[model samples]
Target: MAILMFISRVISLFLMVVLIFYKRKEPALLMAWLLLLVFLPPIGCVMYLLFERTPLPRKAGLFLNDIKDERRGRQASVSLNDKITSLVHFNENYNSSRLYLYQDFMYFADGKSKYQQLFKDIEGAKQSIHLQYFIIREDEVGRQLVQLLTEKAAQGVEVRLIFDSAGCFGTRLKYFASLMEAGGQVYQFHPPTFRLIGLNYNYRNHRKIVVIDGRIGYLGGMNIGNEYMSLDPKFSPWRDAHLRLVGDAVWELQHRFLKDYYMVCDHQEDERYIKDHLNHYFASPLSTTLCPMQIVSDGPDTTTDDIKLTFVKMIQSAVHTIQIQTPYFIPDSLFLETLKIAAYSGVKVEVMIPTIADHHYVYRTTTSFIKELREANIDVYFYKGFLHSKIIIIDEELCTIGSTNIDQRSFKINYEINAFIYDKTLTRQAVHQFQLDLENCLLVDDSYEQNKSAWIRFEEKVYRLVSMLL
Candidate 1:
C-alpha cells in the first residue's frame, strides 16, 4: 500500500509539472487545469490526456506547406487602397492570411435565402464542388442536398464533402451512401476512435464553406440542418448570416478546403499531382471589380488565435460604432475587456444575442456576463427569437461574417473562418440589416440584474468556473 501511494504521488507531481509548463495557454486555463489535476487526480489526468493534448499533430502543417511560398509571392504583388491596405497588413502580419479583391459579394440574412442561392450555385457547377459543414442532419434538407450532390456527381462533376463527427453524430452513414455510390467522396472530421470514444471532442470543424466550380464560394454560420431553416420547432425563426463570393476570394476558400481535405483523406499523391490539381482548380478568371476582402481561418492546429486577434483589432480600430450579433456570448476575459475598453473609449458598442437558447447552460452563462457589460456602458440587446448570426461591423466601412461565435469554444477550440470585407457598399448593407434586426430586439436595462434569482446566480458561478472547457 505504501508503494502504491508513492507511485500515485509521482504521477500527480508529473501532471502538475506538465500543467505548469504548458506554453501559450491563458493563465486562468492553466490554473483551472492545475486545480482539476490536484483535486481529481485520475479523472483529470485522463481528461487532459484525451482533450488537452496537442490540438493538431505536427504532421498537419505539412498539408499546406507546399503552397505557402507560392501564395505569399502572389500576395506580395497585390495592391490595395490606403484603408484596405492597413487592414490587409494587419491580417497578413498577424493572422497570416492574405487579402484579395473580390468582384462580387452577396449577403444572406436567413438560412432559406442562403440555401436557395447555394443550391442554385451547386446546380450550375460544371467542374467540381467542395463543401464542409459542422452539422448535416439526415432530415429533409440534408436529403435534398445529398440528392443534388449525387446527381451532380453522376453528371461527372467532382463532389467532395466533410462533416464533423461530433456535430453529425445523429446522422447515419447510409444517408450519404447514395452520394458515394454516385462517385462522390465524403469524409468526417476527427471521427471517433478507440471503439466509439471521441478523444478529439474538444476540437471540432465548425466552419461552413462551399466552393462550386472553383469560381464561386459560400460561407457563414448556417449549417446544413433543418434547425437552421426554422424547420425545427424548438428553435424557429433562425436568424443567420451568410455570404456569397465571386472572384479571387474563391481561390482562398478553395485552398482552405484542400488543406482540410488532404488532412482528412490522408492523400498520398505526389507533390506534382497536388501542384497540377491546385493550378487547374485555381485557374478561374479574375473578376473585373475590385472589392477588398480577406478570408481568415483559425483552428486548434495553430497556437495563435487569429480570429480572436482579428476581433480585437476590429474593436480597437473602431472609432464611431461597433455592432455585433452572435448566438453565444460567453466571451473570455480578454474579449470582454477589449469590448469594455472600446465602449469606454466613446465608441457606441452594441451587442445583440438570442433571448432563447438552444443550449440552456450556455444561455445562462451568457446572462451572467450582462451585468458587467452593461456597467461598462455597452448596449446589450436580446433578440425575440433565436439569432444565430455571427456578425461584426465597425464604422459602416468594415464588417466580418462567418461561423465564429463570441465564446471560448469558437475562439480557442473549434476551426473557424471569416470574411473581412472592406467596402462601403457592403458594410452599409450589413449596417442596414443590423438596424432592421434591432426592431426584433429588446434593449436590456438595469432591471435585468435585479430579477435574477439565487439559484440562477449560483448556476452562473458554476458555469463560469468551467466556461473555458465549455
Candidate 2:
C-alpha cells in the first residue's frame, strides 16, 4: 500500500510539472484536464495522457519535416504580378497556375440571394454540377435546397454532392440516400466505416463550394440552413460574402472540387483533369483586369498551412491601416502578436465582432480576448447584429473576403477557402462597405472599460483563461 501511494505521488508530480512546462496554448483546457485527472484517478490520468499528448500532425517540428518538400516551392512558382500589381509581393516569392481552363461569374451577398442563385445555376446546368458543404440540415432551408438538387439530378444534370460525415450527421440518412438515388452522386467525406478517418474528428471540410458546367463557381462560409437565410427567424440575419470568378480562377476551383471528389470517390481524374497540349476548355476573353483573383485553399494534405501563413504574411506586410471584421477573435499567439505589433506601429487597427454571440461559450472566450485587444489600442467594435462577415482590408492595397474566419477552427482544424484579390478598386469598394457597416457599429469604448458589470467582467476574465481552446 505504501509503495502504491509513493508511485501515485510520483505520477501526480510529473503531470503537474507537464501542465506548466509544456504550455497548453489554451489555459482553460489545461485546468479542465487537471481537474479531470485529480478526481477520476487512474482513469482520468490515462484519458488525459491519451488525449493531451499533442497529435503527431500538430507537433511543431514533426509537421514541418513531414511537408518540407511540398512547402512554398509548389505555390511560389506561379506568379502573375505583371498582370496584377497586388500580387507583386506574393509573386516575388511564389509561382502560380500557367493557364485557366474554365470561367464563371456569380454575385451574392447573403444566403437568400446565394441559394436562390445556386438553384438557378443547378437548374440551368447541362453537363455537371459539383456541390460541397460543411453542413446541410433537414430543416426548412436544407429540405428546400435538397429538393431542388434532387430534381436537377433527376433531370440529368449529373449532380455530385459531398458533405463531411460529421457535419451531415444531424440530418436524416434517408435524405442523403434520396439524393443519391435520384442520380446525385453523394459521398461522405471521411466516412466512419474507415478507421483511418475515425482517427481524428477535428479535420473537417468546412468549405461551402459549388461548381456548375465547369464554368461557374461559388465558395464561401455560408452553409445550408435556415439560420443562414434569415428564414429561421430564430437568429439575426446572416451577413456574408461570396465571389463569382469569371476568369482562370474558376478552373482552380474546378480542380479543387474534382480533387475532393476523387479523394472520397478514390479515383484519379487523369484524363479529365490533365494539362492537355490541345487545351479543350475555352478561356473567357474577359480580361482578369476586371477583378484578377486566385482561389487559395488550405487543408491537411497541403505541404504547409498556406491559409494561416497567407493571413500572417498579409498582416505583417500591411502598410496602411488594417481593418479586420471577424465574428470570432480567438487568434493564436502568432496572430495576436501580429495585431499588437500592428497597433503599436501606428496602424489604425480595428476589429468588429458580435455583441451578442450565437454560440455561448465561444462568446465568453471572445470577450476575454476583446478586453486584451481593447487594452492594446486595437479599436474593438461589437455589431448590434450578428456580424458574420469574414473580411480583411489591409492598407487599401490588399483585401480578402471569403469563408475563412480568424478563429482556431478555421486556422488549425477545418478546411477553408479564400479569394485573395489584387484589385485596388475592389478593396476600396469592400473597405467603403465595411466602413458603412461600422456606422451602425458601437465601439467597446472606455465606458465598457470603466464600469462593466461585475458578473459580465468576471465571466470575461474566466473566459479569457480558456480563450486558447475556445
Candidate 3:
C-alpha cells in the first residue's frame, strides 16, 4: 500500500508537469487540474486521462469553410446601433457570425407553448426539417416529437436529427427506429463504441436547435422531456426560455445545425450534396423588420471562449442595469470579476437562480458564489421553482438568450449557441419577463448567507473547490 501511494504521487507529479506545459494558455483551468491531482492523485489522474482528451475531429475549421459561401449575397440589410457595434464586431470576427436582420421573434417561457408552436412548425415542413438537441428522453413528449418526425418523413419531407450521445445515454436506438424506417436520418454526436464510456464523455453538444423548411427556426434552453412540460412532480412548474424566429436569422440557425450534422454524420457524399445545394436548405427571407442579431457558437474545437467573451462584453457594455437568469451559476473567475466590476461601476446587477437543484454538487457550488456577489452589492434572487432560463438583459437595449449558462462547462467545454439581440423592443420584452419572474423569487440580503447551516456551508466550500469540473 505504501509503494502504491508513492507510485500515485509520482504519476500525479508527472501529469501536473505535462498539463502545465500543454495547458499553459488556460492558467485557471490548469491550476484547477493541478489542485485536483494534488488532492486526489489516483482518481484525479484517471479523470484527467478520461476527460481531458477530446474525441472531436481537429479539422473543424475546414468543415466550417465548406458550409460558408463568399459568393452569396446578403438576404437582409442590417444597420447596427452605435452602442452595440463593438459587440457585433467582436462576435463577427471571433465566431465568424454575421449580423442577421430577423423579421419576427417569439419568446416562450413554458414548454407547453414552445412545443405547441414547434410541433405545428414540424407538421408544416414542406421541404425539410433539421433538429438537434442535447437530450431527447424516451418519454411521452419525446415519443410525440418522434411520431411527428416519422409522419413528416413518411409524407416525403426530408427529416434529419442529431442528438448528443452522452446526453441521451439511456435512450435506445429502438426508440427512434420508426422515424428512421420512415426515411428519417438520425445521427448521434460522438457515440462511444462501448455504452456511455469514451474520451468524448466530457464534451457534449448542448445546443437545442430546430430549423423547419429553411424558413422558421427554434432554439433556447428547454430540451425534449416530460419534465420540461411540468409532468414530473420533482420539478413541477418548470420555467425556461425559448425562441421562435423567422427571417435571415433562421438561415444562420440552419447553418449552425448543418455544421453539427456535418461533424456527426458519416456520409461524405451526402455532405457534398448538402454543400452544393445550400440554397435549398436556406429559404429566402421575406420579412423586412429591422431586428438585428448574431448567432454565436463555441465549443472545445474553438481556441477562444467566444460565448464567454461575448458575455463579458455584454456585462461591460451595461451602463444602467444587468439582469440575468440561469439554472447553474458556477462562473469562472473572469466572469465573476466582470459582474463584480459592473456592479462596482454603479450598474444595477441582478441575478436569479433556481431554488431546486438538478445536480447536487453543482447546486452547492452555485450557492458558494452568492456571498461574493452579495458582498459586492449585487442583488441575488432565489427563484421559487426550477428556473432553467438562460438569459441576460443589459441596459434594456441588448439581450442574449440561448443554451449558454454562467458556468465553466457551457462557456468552454460544451458545444453551445446563443443569440445576441441588439434590439430594444425585444430586450424590453425579455426585461419584462425577468421582472415578472422576480415576483416568484426571494431577494437575498445580508442575512441569507449568514443563516446557512454549517453542513450546507461546508458542502458549498468543498464543492466550489472543484467547481470548474462541474
Give the clash count for each candidate: 0, 8, 0
lDDT of each: 0.83, 0.67, 0.86
Residue 164 lDDT in model 2? Answer: 88
Model 3 scores worst on lDDT over the 10 consecutive residues at: 53-62
Between 1 and 3, whose TM-score is larger? 3
What's the TM-score of each model vs. the native? 0.93, 0.78, 0.94
RMSD of 3: 2.4
Tens digits of per-residue lDDT for model 3, 257-374:
8778877777778766776666768777767777888899889877788999999989988999999999999888889999999999999999999998899989999999999999
lDDT value, residue 171 of candidate 3: 91
For candidate 2, the 10 contiguous residues with the lowest summed lDDT are: 67-76
lDDT accuracy of residue 279 in candidate 1: 55
| Candidate 3 local lDDT, residue 68 | 56
- The candidate that wins on lDDT is 3
Q: Which TM-score value belongs to model 2?
A: 0.78
